[model samples]
Target: MLTYYPGKTFLHRLDPTLKVLFAFTISTACFVFANIFVLLGILLFEFLLALSCGLWKWGLRSILGLLKLCALLFVIQILTYGDGDVLLRLYGDWVITFEGAEIGLILTLRITASALPLALMLRVTKPTALANSLYRYLHIPYKYAFAFGMAMRFIPIFAEEMAEIMEAQTARGVELDTRSFFKKIRLLMPLCVPLLLSSVRKIETATISAELRGFGLRKRK
Candidate 1:
């Protein structure tokens, strides 16, 4: 789950606005530089920084958790990049090539490089602090800031719920393991309705609570 870790690490101590800016800057750099080496360097730099902050455990877990997604992207690249030195043939008229593989690797690295910084930041920074920083420093409307904060807080909550749901499904003999990402998605789609209903119920409860706490009165002051 991508949630804040309570610690006095450098990233934790850094201003929330600065952390947001730093994450965006790194993410932007990842997209701007298409070179695999640069992407690797950026990723390595992020890991080292996370390690220094004692948050590499969470960062690595988040990154490794996404390897399947990266593999899917790599597969897409191999299938679509029709022209290059033929590397391997999987079937009739479908093949892998050196350039395709290279491009796929770069595409994979690009996405990973873009995502890790933001994920690491979320781990080290509190959602409330971030929202407040956005309001206090940037003068964003209170409601928008509150929405952002609540979204950050709930992302991990829903992720945990989904994990539990998947576990429950597995216990019931739902074969969740599959080589094809699309097949995995198809298998899991049935649970989405329940998850969505749960999310709506939570949102309704939050709305009631917010109303009781004078949610929109903050803008008056």
Candidate 2:
């Protein structure tokens, strides 16, 4: 959803090369720092950064798409991580420990911190600008820089294709919605097959379009 928002804010005016470096630096730091307090500060800093760039609302809203997956991941971490004091007892040999819960929260924060700034950068920077900046500032091959831009452009396209596929299946009364989470997961499994085929078709179409446009043959100047 954050596929170039087009604003004249400070971040939008900043050079794409610097923006890429900033995002990479912050995203990488989320993984490198092991302390929960540091992670929280990173997330807090991201929120401030978003506010400063005039992208607080849109940036946060865009990240909502990852919530479901993040929630699942958080749950998995809590279930698997067994250490520290026992916080709760669910059944025989199954308990939620303080360490597990802490770890889960830490991981969830890390992911959120990592994605927030990158998403804001996407909202501010255009793909063409990114490609140009990479080639000029980093001396990356023109084709590879262009490919990176195209890859960013493809994200929302892929998500759109996925939604359309789901809608099409729903029209056929596939009972894709279920109250049970695991049942919903099973229902989504069928969508992957169609999504993969659709992805291949789209990639093929994109390849043909790129070839016709002389994607790799274009000059830097």
Query: What TM-score quantifies how close candidate 1 is to the native fold?
Result: 0.85
lDDT of 2 by residue, 162-187 (tens): 88887888788877655786876788
Candidate 2: stretches off by over 4 Å? 62-68, 89-95, 177-181, 192-194, 218-221
Output the number of the TM-score-best candidate. 1
Instruction: Report lDDT (CA) for all predictions.
Output: 0.87, 0.83
Under the 3 Å rule for N, CA and C atoms, how many clashes does model 1 have? 0
lDDT of 1 by residue, 1-221 (tens): 57788899778999999998999999999889988899889988988988977877866876776666799889999988878899999888888999999999988988888999888888888999999999988888978998899999899889988888988898898888667867889999998887898999998999899989988876535
* Model 2 collision count: 0
Q: Show model 1 residue runs off by greater than 4 Å.
A: 88-95, 164-187
